[model samples]
Target: MEALGGLPEEAVVNSHVLQFYFHQALAAYRAGRNRDFRQFRDVMQALLVRPLEKDHIMARRLRLMQFLSRVEEGENLDCTFDKESDLTPLESAIGVLELIHTEFAVTQETMETLREMVKEAAVIVCIRNREFEKAAEIVKRHIGKEPKSQVSLCWNERQLLEHCLVCPMGCWGTEVPGVVSGMSYRVGSMTPEGVRGFLEKHAH
Candidate 1:
């Protein structure tokens, strides 16, 4: 923290800076520096409004911070989707990002759904980016945002093996799924059944 403090203020103000601010605020909270925590927290919230920020893959995440800040302050949201964004509430949640202070009977229930959806979305983005530490950090910070279920996925040989790189820390389990599945064929690739037989012979 002291080393970071020695750098110019602009040093931490970059496209992917919120994670740093989030940690700084966390450190402040741990140190019992309420004012410093709030200051960093507020700065994180304010950064969401930058036009450049709105274009990134993590746009939803930046807005997510804004809503989280408001929620921390005990404010309620009537909507969660960005006013300027074309995505619907469902889309925003699916996109794992920003919406209105962000929530409404069925409408109200849907807000909770949105939160959960985005929680998973945030996890996916972290995992897809191979940010395992960040994934754990976020889950610890927002218990409600933790993934509700383990994920099961299937891919071609290349896709399946590549995900291993995403989990350098290693995971608890890996297994073949308990259902039959099939793949489609490209013009020149092996027949689907032939590929299946090949996989059976070379099965891991």
Candidate 2:
């Protein structure tokens, strides 16, 4: 297969040849060969331009490999991708999650790792599109099973929603009372009557 790398561009664009490289890439990734995996990844990226189909296993695998490669390269999976393509990263990740659930009968640990990667990709896509509330929900639903300390991100859903509500301009550090402190402090800081009076006074 190494010899194929020297072939001319026209020859490499054949779907059969691209599929061969896709399988090779998948094998290298699964075998934990980082160098070989990257070599084949570049080949697929260069030659494969067809849209992915969810029901096609090889196509799905190639798309998964491409997504993971972007992630491994520290590229944002959220903002990139052809807008006219059939699947966005978020949609592709969801399809991958469904495939993992129904098609493969893997163990719990392996299942969790696959699910986390797809969910993380989805959340990052939401965040990049300025869908903070949706992103927070995705994080909570898919990735927030562990305790707060075990969760990777520093902020929780409430914190994220609060930031989205109050900081439209994206200045996160500015101090505001109820908004910053969150709803947990609402009862402690103001009585029912006081809250009503405050709202009435501000009503216009």
The candidate maximizing lDDT is 2
**Could you give the C-alpha RMSD of every candidate to the true structure, in order shown?**
20.1, 17.1
Candidate 2: tens digits of C-alpha lDDT, residues 148-191: 54344435433654465455444555443433334232211222
Please provide TM-scores, in order, for all candidate models, with all chains considered together: 0.27, 0.41
- For candidate 1, the lDDT comes to 0.40
lDDT of 1 by residue, 62-163 (tens): 544443333232111233445775332333443332333232011444445445534433433344444445544444444333343432223432242233
Once fitted onto the true fold, the runs of candidate 1 whose alpha carbons sit more than 4 angstroms away are: 1-13, 26-36, 45-56, 75-204
Off by over 4 Å in 2: 1-20, 23-91, 121-134, 137-152, 155-158, 161-171, 175-204
Clashing pairs in 2: none
- Top of the candidates by TM-score: 2
RMSD of 2: 17.1
Worst 10 residues of 2 by lDDT: 183-192
User: What's the lDDT for all of these models?
Assistant: 0.40, 0.49
